[model samples]
Target: MSAANAPTQSQLEKDIELIKLIRSRGLVPLITAEERPDVPRLSDVQGDVIYGFPKASLNHALNIEWFFFFRIADSGSFKAGLSNPDFKPTSSEDVKNNLLKIGKARQEAKLSGEEVKRVKLQQYQIAFSKTGLLVLGIQDGIADARFDQRCMRDDRVFLGDQGKWDDLFDKPGYNEKDGSAHDVNNPRALHGVFVIAGDDDKECADITEKLKGIFKSSIEIPENGIVQGHVRPERHLEHFGFRDGISQPAIRNLEYPLPGQNQVDPGVIVTGYKGDPVGSKRPDWAKNGAMLVFRKLEQSVVAWDNYMLDHGQDYKDVPGGKAGVNPELSQEDGAKLLAARLVGRWPSGAPIALKETSLKDDPKMGEDPKRNNNFDYSVYDVPGVSAQTPSDYYCPFTAHVRKTAPRNLDPYVARQYLESGSIIRAGITYGPEVTQKERDDKKDSEEEKFKRGLLFVCYASHLDSGFVRQTTGYGNNDFFPITGLVPNNHGQDPIIGGPPAKGSSGEERDANLDAKPAKPFANGDQLDIKLKVPGDTLNRYQVTGHVEIQPLTQAVIDFPFFVTSRGGEYFFVPSIPTLKTWGTAN
Candidate 1:
């Protein structure tokens, strides 16, 4: 995909028209791609567009992030806050300049044999919801249909449907009839989110102090928005102990592309770029801006761990066990394996399709980008094994990774269309580490003592076909199709899946996994596989001697509520020029 800086004459005219429309609506002046300083070009690994917000940046330890929610109490005060040189919203020019300075600093530090303690400056980006635009006094007539349709709504994009709410073990806050913590009516409803990220807590705190003073009475800092720091030790891991953000699509304009990373068109993410993913006519003001989806997902770690302990042993008879490749593992080890299958990768970040034996041994493999994310479940050729099958035998079809991407399995009209579903995930795990004392206390509830979960943030041009489709169509659907596999309702995603309704009594919803019998081993031992379908109480097959007649073994497990939605909103991250205009507007 070509860079967004250059547009044809007709397109340029459209941009001009867009600017006029925005001005007519009294919108803050937005920076156009043409006016902004060129993003410093660098190698694929170092230089790129959309600085400071990508999966690679999360690998840096000591990283601290702050989420600020502000309500425009007085439009003039808010404008004054934006105009303040010290607390002015960061522009793309600011980001590029900062990156160049940081790069130079790193090089100087390395040459001078000096330790770089912390970045003196903090990096932040500003985005606003439809409510925020209104608060800023932009008329509703200026907003486009797509933005109005998505950003103006308060329902949870993934779980708001009545059917899905009924199916979940614990409904999201918005789903409840009574106003709750996450309800739209709650005071937590926010108009804008300002994200500040730094090298350490001190830097973040310093920036937060400055921002508080700058905005003062214009913004409301809710108690909930105070500060949710990222957890330690397992910095990148989610509360459930799985490495998050392992899978991300490679953007077209990047210089360096990692192995197995799918290259997506710029239009798929940035608005008005060539090959716009939405394929619908949009207002010119929408160009160059991207939609942001935010969700606060809280995890029940204690409940999740306990469920694994009770059911992990059941998977011992799974693929590895039947193939005789797996060692005789204790109950704890068995449970760990079961957890990995649900997550699609081990805690070490290694894909299960590559390593199935011991989760701890292949830490090196997981760290290597070339090998870590290179597996395709649809058609995989296992290393050192000659027999290649098109089935997702090694990796379950319902695995979190499989359900989200589906890779070649996507039935979209073309391959590029399939790649459009990709979104840049900028999520951070928020919560405290479980203490040994907390782990040992059998009677104590960990959920009560600790608040932990994921702050899911992603950028996409189209919410309906991108983030919404992945969460609702892929994450929620159980009967997601796979070629050559029989049509089976594989149940909800074990980790993030929600049931159609809360199960009767205390029993959780049942999720099915299709366990294909292992191919005849090279060692010449025929493994006997016995499949048990839960709720199969009638013994109908027992009388017919058809126990082994079923082509695939279906293992049904009780899946409980693992993750719950706290709150979220949709926002539009405008260009730097537009922000500047907003600040200086009369």
Candidate 2:
């Protein structure tokens, strides 16, 4: 498709991809710029941005938004049993205990295959202490102007492989094996806002701290301009349960992306869609700039669990007994399956309903860095292949990744993108891991039951198309049409759909039979699962019957929806140049 016709789905996909990078390394929540004014002023940035925000003007002050991930800050003091003094760190010898802790963390960190573990071992390497983060939600009105004036002209610091594309192509992963093109315009990528969060952890922290002070005490910005980084515990699991970052676009020439897409030209993610309705509205200052959407979406754990219980199936067995709902499934075998279907991937990060190449995680394949995320879903010897296409399966349609971009099933993945195309998301998990207080309260109040999730902060080329279009409609809305194999049966995503209520329509996901045991047919409120016989003669083709999806959008079927968004906000990350000019502009 031409740039003008670029789909909004592309932008949201990039945001997911970007955030996933942050999650894998535990290095997101990139800090940038110092705040000063009432409405903090920002330097003009390049490219399109997302989120609902205010316009920056000559008389305004700068607002510097900082990201504070819950995991990094949730101190042991908050919870009792889970993080007691003897949990691991408090009572041990400093270095000796730290080594053990590092070892344990390393084991868990291998979710990215081995690349993440092998990359480096400094706590501050990815998200440094001194590094300042400047997050923004480019207001819908001035997205074009802010992006142009700030993005392209800025130093483009903190971010990697951005300024250097050609050199990345010569790396080992770029030459062969994966056939997918690494287009810069892949829906999942970042285009605007140069990061000042340096390479070292200390530097990142130090700079970030200093910048925070600037936002708080500065005289130039507005009072409401800068939103201090504080832990918002009540709302979403994390700040706002954004499946913080997944599905980043692979920039053309950049070698060995974590996985997902290829690259393309910077322009694709820096302007409005080629034929976008808002393309003609851009101003001179917004030429190369992109939009940034900052959402504060909240998740209702209690409600989510209740929805699952009301509509989900019962666990026939746990390690010792049978338990089906959240708490019941917490440590049960079924718990793992429930969470897997919810996230569309095993906690190991493996997709449940979908598997790209094989069921197992391949070190050579999973850690290829480049080829890992580059595969597009090709039909399984036929057109409109549904069950585990070449790209990804073992998950559900509404799962986070697929819901955001919809993948190549559209054939448009290979086409030229619209100006307001790609998006690059980056966020961090926030809040405590299932707190006792919250869990206890959940038995009665859903508002108190949620576990920690991710604080979502994303950058996109266009606001309305990228972040706005996707979350609000593409993946956010339940009615988004799924142009799938069965046409009418193409349902919305089951795991991470954009439903109004967690599961207002009541849904259920069906997991085909696993090796150990299979969940029996369940009768839920609006969700019911009954095995179907595919061929002419009814009960013929059958395997290890498992559970998959019954989406909310297609209420007729029983797809249990897992992930949900509660609330969020919009802000802007000005270009470094924009930051410097903020106070002085007027």
Candidate 3:
């Protein structure tokens, strides 16, 4: 209300122009409160903190983006570029300020009866690899083993890359035996990457070129540096035709938690926060920074579709088939059902856990945040459902979602996963949609220049506890969730899971689609006991004794290869102050 603090007319005009630019690009400038969990306070560290990725909804955050990877040539010049206003990365406070300005400008326009226009603003963020740190003389390191591992090329054995690397990532002159680039500081080494995003491709390109020019002497920008990704126009789907970016964890303070969304402390994501694995031992300059995991996963759409079609009619009996019920489904419907079960959601983004028997996508439920991510894969959350928990009777334990986040499977496991194993996914689909020819042929054509895949990007404070664990430990591992159920191993994650085979395509894996607990769970179906109150009169299911599940006729499904990791690297996103420090000194 104070006049002194009021924004000047010029500033208001500037904000309105910003809004218009965004609208011109067909984007909404407003970021949902529930989706901005990574944004920190403006006053925190004098507005020095930077977002690990765009702190907006998936649509807004990745509308149009570019990942420009470069190698350091001159350390002094590269360090100086960090402080250059034109070349520096965008700060978290800058994003928050823009959101506020846009809001204020919209309100002013509404009051003045002026037509409000949306805004699109480009954001630039920087992250450096371990070698980049050494190049910049941060010799002590950030103290993360997985990150300090140096080259993701070496991680191929565990990540299952199997030498299917893009030429750009698999540059020459690396020690083939040890998987180390012969010269760590070579001009071809991946030192750092710059992420630029907005709604304009030309504008993004211009910025990319500008930054390249600015750091021309300090770095070498390869052809792959121009790789761009975009969010599909239809329902925000990925190349796989499924709605993506659902079920992201809610940060404790940054966002208003959605129903059933696991909310963790900022330390779980940003360093120097409450839940960080390294705790206060992290260097002071590394505060507010997060580790970035960048993986380019190429999807074989044709192969996946054919595999689903081939197995669609072979439906598996549920709940251990105790009732000897195997629902007959048409091949068409069966294929859809198979895909949904594999992804743990329909193409519309609805959770298969909530709509287990449905063969069609629930557009309403999928788009409804209040319901889409509200399921916990247990009968305890299903209304009016009487329990005898059958153990993944609805959502298969091998389903992509369940494997990545076994929410509420076990209280301790869920808590532990939320605390350390979670990652903030801000990836965007890269390449192009499959062509009609490719679809008709039931395979991607050799003539097709661009392949379709996901530019998988995620963030976390501890690389080991976050992305690495989710991929190698859970997604790729069998016998996870440790449910002590019969059959022991549930299966590998159907989407991204890789069995313990290194240097292989991971083309085939086993999954228990119809898992059953040796004995039925005691608790009957009821609203989550966690939500129950002392005097609440809600009916609760309580079947005291044990319930037994009979063995199913069909239990395991042979999973096929779908996602192939082309290449990736782990980078450290430093704080604004840290950048300034690096720029001013070594």
Best by TM-score: 3
What TM-score would you give candidate 2 relative to the actual structure? 0.47
True-vs-predicted CA distance for residue 183, candidate 2, Å: 40
Q: Each model's TM-score?
A: 0.72, 0.47, 0.77
Residue-level lDDT tens digits of model 2 in 213-296: 433322122222222222333211232232222345543221124445534343344443333335468543344344444433
Compare candidates 1 and 3 on lDDT and give the better one: 3
Model 2 CA deviation exceeding 4 Å by range: 1-246, 253-260, 271-281, 301-334, 352-374, 379-395, 411-421, 437-451, 477-481, 484-491, 494-566, 578-585
**What lDDT score goes with residue 162 in model 3?**
45
Tens-place lDDT per residue, model 3, 1-586, is 1356556767766655554433311112333222233444432322212233332242333367788898888898888787676765676656656555555556676689986544567777788888788877787657776666557765665564543677667655554234452246455668888888776688688878788777778988776666678766663678777887777776665544556777777788778777888866777888878888888887888888888789876666443342333456667777887898888898888887764433457888787776777767767545555443435667777789887866765532556654578787777787777888887888875553658788888888898888878876777666666654454567788778653222356454333325574654552111121223347678543322112232465355455667777788778888777788887884
lDDT of each: 0.57, 0.35, 0.66
Off by over 4 Å in 3: 1-62, 98-116, 171-183, 318-330, 355-360, 381-390, 411-414, 485-487, 499-557
Q: Please list the residue runs of candidate 1 whose C-alpha ends up more than 4 Å from where it truly belongs after superposition.
A: 1-62, 91-121, 140-147, 150-153, 157-188, 320-323, 355-361, 380-390, 410-414, 442-449, 481-487, 499-557
Best by lDDT: 3
- Count clashing residue pairs per candidate: 12, 175, 8
